[model samples]
Target chain A: MHIEVVANIGEARSDDLLHKTVIVVDVLRATSTIITALANGCKAIVPVETVMKAKEQVQEGDLLGGERYCKKIPGFDFGNSPLEYTREAVQGKRIILTTTNGTRGIQKSMKADHILAGALLNGRACAQAAIALKKDTVILCAGTQDVFSFEDGICAGLILEELTYTLGEKNVLINDFGLAMRGSYLHSKDRLFETLVSCANGKKMSRSGFHDDLILCAKSNIMDQVPIWEHDQMILLPRSLARSTF
Target chain B: MHIEVVANIGEARSDDLLHKTVIVVDVLRATSTIITALANGCKAIVPVETVMKAKEQVQEGDLLGGERYCKKIPGFDFGNSPLEYTREAVQGKRIILTTTNGTRGIQKSMKADHILAGALLNGRACAQAAIALKKDTVILCAGTQDVFSFEDGICAGLILEELTYTLGEKNVLINDFGLAMRGSYLHSKDRLFETLVSCANGKKMSRSGFHDDLILCAKSNIMDQVPIWEHDQMILLPRSLARSTF
Candidate 1:
């Protein structure tokens, strides 16, 4: 029941992931987009490491949506925007995602015993899903270009706080960075979005006019469906599990 | 400054380490051994990745010490025990040290702009050294057998805490795992050794009769020198510069 937090996907590997339940967090956009698409009724999302691989993975009918530098690639049906994923646009369709960070992050955890997509949008659900598995958990935050991102760390804090509430303190294990995030959350609860926009990685996105994306990521508990990775496809669960019952 | 916490040497090879200050920690023994050797008046220590390479690296007059599976390899002058690094035995002598984990951890940071060894014995010193450089730092924990180790996590926490005290709250950056370690330190400050021994990796080591090693590792402030890797050698400093004067 010990929970471990790794700095980023680059810090985790296939062997290190063995026998551990993994919750992947990419709060800026990729994880949010995956959660939004699946919550809106998409069948599945296939995540790939590179744009070229994702293009080849998509068949004639599957929709492609991802970004390289926070913008949509030419011919991509959509960029890494939660707003682009709606019931009308993504329902009953398949998405081949290849974001610069998130998809690569997911690919790195391909060997995880249990992999779940997490973001501030579905922070509660991710924690709930982890508690349901009844195993030690490892939370891997997809940091920005291998650097710590306040947005992702804050989202991980939300999960850590929720999991601690549900699973009890004894079952919880966090690293120094995780504790700092929880501390940051407490210090900036009244100005969460403002805090998100102030981080180094967050400011980079802001300068590129992605303030709307930051706002979308700031909203918490917008979705309850846990996006679980099974085989090579990322899928969603209908009902959330409560750790108290487990 | 940003602080990245890596899980192991294997995962630390990502492109992010370039141009960044790297502080490597193998607190169980490698780092502690290096710190102890330097503090006890050893001339220099050459760290190597494997036992075969370690033997090859030693010169005619230098002593070799290494271990595998918690036992000393045959023909080495000593095993991977800090207690063996006595001032009378190692004074002014060149030592070539290798171990199952620690040396590999140091070698992995060869690409880093600045590399230093970190341990609870020298945690404050390591942080001070990083802060004096006035650059972002990455804390690479060389956990046991390429998996997360509780002892290393807590040691990294102490370093993070020291950094936070010296740098302003916003100036210091930590990943999710780093945050979690800080939380563990606060929650289990009184029984740091007991808590670590109860962890999965620690339990395994104790079961294998390495409990004494764990006890030695829990001690703090034994060495005041900061061991920095410069020009392919680990050199000790008077005191770390990252600490606050106040």
Candidate 2:
């Protein structure tokens, strides 16, 4: 299997993503929030590129969830925080989500054969989901404003590490960027929270009072569910179906 | 002290580099060769972006050196290999040099306050030179064909680690990409040659009979000299002058 880890959405070519499984990672909030919502029983997440599109996609029963610049969109149920995506708040509801980078990444990967939302919370599960899909993979780190972000790169490293572990090192062929990310992940795995805290977004979010979010997103493999794109919405990959495909 | 580690030439913005000290790294050979040539008593290296420019710049006593697709240009004096630039061949002689990526990187960084050639062999010296220049630094990894390469990224990491060690962590402010590279460098410092051999360019160079070059380029901080852009060419920074700036 071949894995190419793109540094940011700006560097990702849609043509390269074609016929491949693209894992979109936004650990500073987007993908992490998606994974959290799904794991906490959100029915589905419709990720759109713009706030207006997210509003248009919403139906009577659906919840509008997203952020613009790390703040909750006006009249939306929540910001881009996993902690806000509790079982009591999101259970059995569909969410129309739009954020700065993560949703834009998913939109850019529309041509991919499979689009899986990946974060540290579900890194191993995302790797397994890609394996089950049986396509060359592209891990797109949804960096901030087209610049590479440490949290997303770290999440990409976690998924690449998981893929290498499950597929065996010899069976996996990773691009140089992925290889660097894997090394970065291995070096910082022991102090993930501290690592996240040291990055730009981490410091921004911490100053903005999202310290708990950093702690939540820094934990690896805490959730076994993977959110996969299907029919214009992201839903959990059925556990039994994923296992049987292995 | 602020530092930005750009993944490739394509991603570097000229405005961000203005007034900053830029260290251009191409560890698969470009900067490494330049460092070796200067350390071996080469007078100066004029880095150009094209074969025609290299030829045009050559004087009566100048040596023409460059590579096209990892092979020596048909009639050049040497290829992009440090070993080929022996003291007997390059002593007190100017060289007109061009390569696929590294020269392009230096060309792109013309707006910077100072531009220095950096590779694993001279990473520490390059870091010290940047400190002596007393400007915010940008480590531009001259990746292959606008994509990130492991060797260059590792060299950037090595330099970042050196800067952090000398300046102290609290005083040195690094961007997220630089942080990732520093982590990667720390992780693979013990087995750099193996790490390089596993990367794409490394594998290509090894298969093309440049195995020795890989071994030579993988050694960290082997050279105590740095090549800085002065006037229109790259020359060794005077050790006394650099020390005096400190």
True contacts kept of each: 0.02, 0.85
C-alpha lDDT values of all predictions = 0.77, 0.92
The sequence of per-residue lDDT tens digits that candidate 1 reaches over residues B1-246 is: 988777566667746777788888887778988888888999888888788888778888899988877788899888888888899988998888886677777777777788888888878778878888777888998877676666777777788888898787778767655665565455555666786676665676688887877787777655668788876778775453544232
Task: Please write out the lDDT profile of model 2 over residues A177-226, one tens digit for every residue.
Answer: 99999999999999999999999999999999999999999999888898
Q: What docking tier does model 1 reach?
A: incorrect
Give the number of colliding residue pairs in candidate 1: 20
CAPRI-style grade of the A/B interface in model 2: high
Mind sharing the TM-score for model 1? 0.68
Task: Give the number of the best model, judged by DockQ.
Answer: 2
Which candidate's lDDT is highest?
2
Every model's TM-score: 0.68, 0.97
| TM-score of candidate 1's A chain against the true A chain | 0.92
DockQ of each: 0.09, 0.89
DockQ of 1: 0.09
